[model samples]
Target: MDIKNIRQEMALLDDVIPLEGHHYAACLQTYEAASSQRKLILEWFTNHVIPQIPRDSASFLSIGCGAGELDVKILAAAKEQASTIAYVGLEPDSKQCERFTASMALPSDQNIRVETLNTNFEKYTEQRRFDRVLMVHSLYYMNDPERAIEKALNLVNESGKLIILIASNDTLNELSSSFWQMENGGSTWFSEDLSKHLDKRGVAFDRHRIKAKLDITSCCAPESEQGIRIADFIAQAPTGELPPGLRTMIFSYLEATSHLDGEMRWLPHNVDAFII
Candidate 1:
């Protein structure tokens, strides 16, 4: 990673403008289509974790379950063992919450009782503990990840488990960290940091490495709308709106990090699953 180069470029910028509204949504869609985030998580949760799922309560507590797309799949994974799934999602984004509520209304999710709270994990006031808890790809948004993890764990019943999906010094996150700092004024945490925190707290956990990738050929196309959108998603910022030097630097870093295999540009999208 060209951390120094990105830092140099970011220093030339006033601030990072985070992509929001429809543009962000579009970029996310492109990223999702190219990445295997949902499939990897769903398969791992079903094959490796679901068999050991405690049957105390068919209830599931998902922290930062965005838009309910993955939540529906997760609940489905537990369906073979439990007739119905009680799903409660915690997300601070109201727009996403609305989408979640709408998506959960589909007949396919009829067996799951879905409840969404447009609030952060730290602000959830539910006193009821859940039999299973999940915090997939959502921990990076936490102001205090340790507190949030402890809170999520506290919400899990004795026989239940807490599954936290995060990245292990995820390469793409390194490319985005500089922009994130500019946007949030602080550094973000990764799986290694979380593991160290758990170890320091004497919380034993099993870490599983899940491999995935993305076809980032579109991201390499500097002028195309789809390319810009994917690049924006990668940097978590408006790549086109960025300072010229920083924008070029970031794309250079991305291109350098990505490897070419025939006609496809494969960008590593690996993640780590921490099961406690």
Candidate 2:
């Protein structure tokens, strides 16, 4: 399979379908099964970001919080530090919202409140500000990421901050960037572009890079059902729906990008956190 041929095929594809809630959930499951990226993110957030937060009392506004996986851990840290915390999560998908809400059941003895809004940032009606506003890997899918950043920044209190967790252009992007370019008619935002935008706008922010790796051993196997799901996730499409030649190229691309470590394949999966 030719990588160059795959790029040409990806460019020929004009229409891109957004994944349904269930599809996204399945993809996430497949991704996490072979990746420790999110675990690293939680650790970094707890050590680096949480320490900078106010310990007395805090309010958290999590934008596009899906399944509340990392948010719950962050909330636990906040609850441990602060006397009270008012946490609100914004998620548009009902399925992920259900999962997010279910995991957010803190102990009754805790002086914390959790609320989930089944809406995006643009439709959120409350004028309430938060101590920390987070958009963890959600900016890419927002209707307008730049505007969303601006609005999220506005919703932060004077002494508070808006934190954005975005992925960097690692080997993961090497596998998916062509799909994104054809789908969006432009390149998606990576850490470099985000930093450049902030610098050009004279926006002051601190950046933290979390280096990590993804185990794509399953993704490298041709007969692994989980591998197909992960390939779908990487390409953001139904792999079964893809043309045979293109699908072969997709797997070939993955095997090419990943480095062999023992019997497993590892792919670079670094992420960046921007504090505004």
Candidate 3:
């Protein structure tokens, strides 16, 4: 499907699937499973990357800042350095942004300001430049990722940074096999050669790999319940419809591998943090 079609279908799914308690719980479970991976990704940035960036830079922008988790983390880190950081989050989902705003308890006295825009980054015009622009695990949703990156590049102040954390195509191929098998097809949004694309564009970036391990058995009853709810929500979507056998297989696969036996493994994602 084209970009327009994908957006329409996603909008429909968002309307049809109410992301309430169960959905949030499931997301939390997913987050727990991926916490280590997330930490590693962030650690790399804080230790190796952020030090290189001048703390005096004016602002930081995180595109698709779902639930503002990363925003909170980054802000907390910057606070430790007594950095007067301004944060801007651009999210496509209004509901998610609202939830994030409601739940966040960032330091009020700190020189940190958080603003979220409820619109697609591609269409949302940026009026000001930022010292850092980040797209974490959210770039694949864009209609034209290259154009999105280009726009992100444009939003950066001179000598600013643009960080993109995307799942490598191979990782998607493994984890989303069922998704790819669906007949209610969509265009492959993932870039198989994302690093090359960035290099060709002369975007200087450092790359890292994050390993996400899911252990089904370790999931408590609450977590499993949330997972089931998420599965149901996902299964009901048009793009999520799969042959019965395949669907069953996917669920069974998820159930069987929840214990982190190292049996169920996804490939490392290509995480690129570019200095523009």
Cα lDDT computed for each candidate against the true fold: 0.81, 0.83, 0.58
- The count of residue-pair clashes in candidate 1 stands at 0
The TM-score leader among the candidates is 2
Give candidate 1 misplaced runs (Cα > 4 Å). 106-111
Q: Which model, 1 or 3, shows the larger lDDT?
A: 1
Q: Which rank order by lDDT, best down to worst?
A: 2, 1, 3
Q: Which structure is stronger by lDDT: 1 or 2?
A: 2
| RMSD per model, one decimal | 1.9, 1.7, 6.5
TM-score of 2: 0.94
Write down the lDDT that model 1 would get: 0.81
What is the RMSD of candidate 3? 6.5
Cα lDDT tens digits, model 3, 12-113, are 432332233545445544644543556777787688656765666457888888787666777767666636777788877777788667655565755667
List TM-scores for all candidates, in order. 0.93, 0.94, 0.73
Please write out the lDDT profile of model 2 over residues 1-276, one tens digit for every residue: 556778887667656675566887898788876787889988988887788777778899999999998899998877667887889999998988999999998768567889999987788878899989999988877666688888888899999999999988766875566676676676678888789989999999999988888788887776798888788888777777777877888888888878899998888888899998
Clashes (N, CA, C under 3 Å) per candidate = 0, 0, 8
Error of 3 at 63 (Å): 0.4
